[model samples]
Target: MKLQSTLVFSNELPPVKKLGEEILLIYDQILAQKSPSFGKWAKGISLKYPVKAGEHLKDIEQFPRHIKAITKLTEQTSVKKLTVVVVGGGSVGDFGGFVASILKRGVRLINIPSTWLAAIDSAHGGKTALNVGGAKNQIGTFYPADQIIMVRTVLMAQPEARAFEGFGELIKISLIEGGKLWSSLAKEKQINSKTLWKYLEAAVHAKYKVVAKDPHEKKGIRHVLNLGHTIGHVLESHYELPHGIAINYGLNFALRFSVQKKVMKPAEASRLFGEPVMGFLLSPLRDDLISVKSSDLAEYRRLLLSDKKKTKAATLRFVFVKKPGKTVIQEVTVDDLLIELCRQREEELHG
Candidate 1:
């Protein structure tokens, strides 16, 4: 499956005049306060929906009202000519993409990701998602966008701290693709917007290569993309950490687990950990974030079971790193995962 979206890199947001005459701009409401120029530009759109960006926006219960409002908003326009332009981070992209996929049995969708995380990962995958009963991505579709516009100005405009959140996904794809992407990235000492921009295109193309093999995820080739996401999602929901930050910790967990299981050689694991770029993966808040108490075990079990990748009643497909560019998937029971979680946490405290 070839990547269908046209990928374009630009210094600034595409001019509104070029977005076509009939466009419905669905953007994050926060952009108005965060980026004045973007606010001004969005004001030019005749039909626009400004949304609060986060997990709440993707709630399935609320989707009915949202879809109803959007349907009424664009009732006058011809669906053939109408284009839904989604502008924001992952959550907004998920919500907007889902809308475009179902709105009038599908419409032209263009993604203008506003955050580094969105620009680097979520915005490209064409996976639109929503939550059900507090579970993440329980309902979603593989709706690829017609165009994905990556604006340097928009991504750079984010707060410097936001770069760390994006770094997790950047490192993830680099590890999954390895070779030149990992070799060059491993040498970098600093991680900032410039670092992210330098390798944005490479990281995106690497993800496309994975997605192309398993466009709809039927063959499980794309499961590798969830390399760090298994436990990442658990932490994200448990502590409400940003998706990228949680994934960083999850990647660390997976690497450690790989060594414990004898999947990755200890020498290679140590070498990977010793790299300058790998230093950024060590979050100072690691203890506070992952120090799972016995009482928390029940909740963690619940979250793990709720995971979409579950292969059995109590088991899920876990992605383990054998080395850069190669991953191994194995099914492990929930108890096995919780035990590892405890072991890793104890090691962090004492080892």
Candidate 2:
């Protein structure tokens, strides 16, 4: 076959190649599955394909100008067979996937996630989005990637903090899926594509399995995936912290809230989140949104009310831990949430 963009799975897959091992083995195992014309992963499933890597750069504030740049690149590159663009995850995946979802009505997408966050979380279930104004993921789509590409080698260049951020997703994945995968990564001396693939695979599998059941996140089952994200996304917007780190921060606050609400027991929360959780909280939330104000609680509540996932009655659905590997979405009033948010912020300041 010449080439075509399609998702693939191998039942008789070859043994994984080592991190610094053969280049061809690395390519065949992961990169070969992408777009071949561009030497991209999703389009490159067959052999005899040439590869070229492109630079994708964006800051949190560059969405409009960035989209225009991508549009011009599409026109400049004008290859008729180009059906999609594969975005490596992290902020780039969110931005690129959002652009691809809108361009020419829509284009094919294969997410080749390089960062820990993208591999375990952002890569597969193609809900592409961009931030509008100051809100996080304010705009997005339900488009799923035609294929999901993951390789541990791509994550090798990431720094320790970035690795830690990805670990937060691994933690969330463990919460929803199970603890076996997380325990394995915790034992590793250092994380890399080779050793980290197991965690990524577990996360991707959990996401794909949920998406298979509820493709649009309309059903309650999919909401379980958002366990720590309700507070995580908010903190990310308000604090300007890295997404993964911000999630770790959010997970702390959410679990605390869940405990206060009596939705889950304190000991169980400690087991999932390591003990002395309070000590591990991300400090100095400096962004305008996260900066503590007289109305921080009110602002947080307002944003929660704006979420598209809210019911027609304007009630908010929050994902809370029922126990490890289980979560439940509870609809609570804006006033009630604000009171709880204030109480938590007060405790954080006092202790």
Candidate 3:
């Protein structure tokens, strides 16, 4: 499945105007209250599947119930002309995208990302997923939406706290692409929704560049995208942290590990962190704020192994940064990650 195209519009919802006659809108219920025009835009929608939207929404056990409801809701509509327009954050997009991919054996799908996190990262990827028990993204598909529409009002409507969430992916992309994005972004005095909007295009482009290289992830090229995601997913599942916030810590861990393992020059690592912007994104995480027992270490390892992207029996092709725009992938085991986690936690306590 080739990703069709992305339209990043400011203060407009232009793509929704041309939606197919039989539109099956799977939206976050929160949007109805948050977005002023959400109701108006949803006026003529054939079927509206309003979801709560979160990691819980991706539970595999709950999936059959959701799909069954959607099946009944769309039974009367013409599947050929049906379009699944998903409007929400990442989780809603994942659940809706998965629904659209399998609904009537694949239908035209569109995404109207309502959160900066979704607008900047997850919504564009074409990867749909559902979780098994507590494990994240265990089952999924590569179903790219036909179009991705980024509406300013909807995105801007998010709570200010949500900007912190968006920043993780925003910063991750900049660091991955490095060069100009890193230089300019690092100079910012403050990061807010506007800052996120300004770099939205570049971040999305950076992600697409990686995805295009290994769209199906058959080649190892795309594994670089998992820079912070390995430990990030574990923290998100174990600590119940927001995905973006968990990634912020995960990115920090990866950068430090890169330097500690002698894979990246200390000078290069210092230069990357010396940027004023790193101060906000690299602040101490909850892991540092709290103490970890051996039981916690065992639990963390269990969650880490459940990441679904491990290569060998207990190894992962962890992404390491050599410098801005330069990254290397190396085979790492669970024990290596555990040791680093403990070492990092100890350092946080001391310093």
Q: After superposing candidate 2, which stretches have Cα over 4 Å from the reference?
A: 1-80, 98-108, 130-140, 182-198, 270-293, 306-314, 345-351
Please give each candidate's TM-score: 0.93, 0.66, 0.91
Candidates 2 and 3, the one with greater lDDT: 3
Winner by TM-score: 1
lDDT of 3 by residue, 143-228 (tens): 99888888888888899889988999988888899888889998887888989888888888898988887778888887787889
What candidate 1 gets wrong by more than 4 Å, as runs, is 1-3, 283-288, 307-313
What TM-score would you give candidate 1 relative to the actual structure? Answer: 0.93
Instruction: Tell me which residue pairs clash in candidate 1.
Output: none
| Poorest lDDT segment (10 consecutive residues) of candidate 2 | 18-27
Task: Count clashing residue pairs in model 1.
Answer: 0
Candidate 2's displacement at residue 149, Å, is: 1.8
- Residue 113 error for model 3, in Å? 1.0
Model 3, residue 92: distance off in Å is 1.2
Q: Which ten-residue region of model 1 has the weakest summed lDDT?
A: 282-291
How many clashes (backbone N, Cα, C below 3 Å) per candidate? 0, 11, 0
Ordered from best to worst TM-score, the candidate numbers read 1, 3, 2
